[model samples]
Target: MGQKSGGYDLNLFANPPNCNFVCSVCHGVLKRPVRLTCSHIFCKNCILQWLARQKTCPCCRKQVKRRSLVYVNKLRKAIGRLEVKCKNAEAGCLATCPLAHRRRHQDSCPFEQMACPNDGCSMRVQRWALAEHRRYCQHSAQWHCPLGWLQ
Candidate 1:
């Protein structure tokens, strides 16, 4: 999902498909994902640090190759796996979900999402990305790591 300089071209992420992979950390379904050259998928930061420390695929424990790691695009995957609902709990949003339901859910899930409060970090990521956010937020006194830690 690299972007060109002229303008934001999100063509690669124009769509998504449904999926499920074990959370690399807790082995949960909810860990955010990324694809590796081995075709194995794992949570974003999970594999990064996993690679940093292990340098092997979390799934197969094989040596990870170069730059093949990338985030699993939610919008792209939602097309197949997501089930849409009205998202309004009280309204009983039983409208029957569509493939494009994730972005809406991220914006609507009462218990699944939250926006980063960093003054300029405009990311509305899942709860896990919060630790990644706070580590790099310019406004947070506790921001650490030599790297900015954004992905």
Candidate 2:
């Protein structure tokens, strides 16, 4: 699935956003959206890259200039207020945080899975449980067997 800037699952919204909140170029949720003189909105990076190649707005094909782009503060604030599910929801995370803070929670969520650090270990464990796994991982160089020969 595409990663949404606000971590929101667009399908969960009561009224799914229409064109106003979607980027014409990427056809996804807008991230750091900016508006053009033609009153069309697009993700800043998408429009800037498009402008570099052509001088017309992607939707209306109207003449536009890079300098005419302006941040859509109202839309930005609205997106920030949206409630989003944790990115690790499929991994059994049940917490729902505001869009603005979803990234922070996802970064440290107890349910976030991570690969084992041991060279030969292929285990994937939750971030919070990595330390415990590390202690017992036989593949880890730091883990010494009870017998002296295995050290």
Predicted structure with the largest TM-score when compared to the true one: 2
- Give the lDDT of residue 9 in candidate 2: 42
lDDT of 2 by residue, 1-151 (tens): 2533332346544346655677767776677889999999888888887889999998899999889899998998877776777777788888887677887988889999999988989999999899988877899886865564455
Q: Which regions of candidate 1 fall more than 4 Å away from where they truly are? A: 1-20, 30-32, 70-81, 84-151
lDDT of 2: 0.78
What do the candidate models score in CA lDDT, each in turn?
0.53, 0.78
Error of 1 at 36 (Å): 1.9
Deviation of model 1 at 67, angstroms: 1.6
lDDT, residue 43, model 1: 57
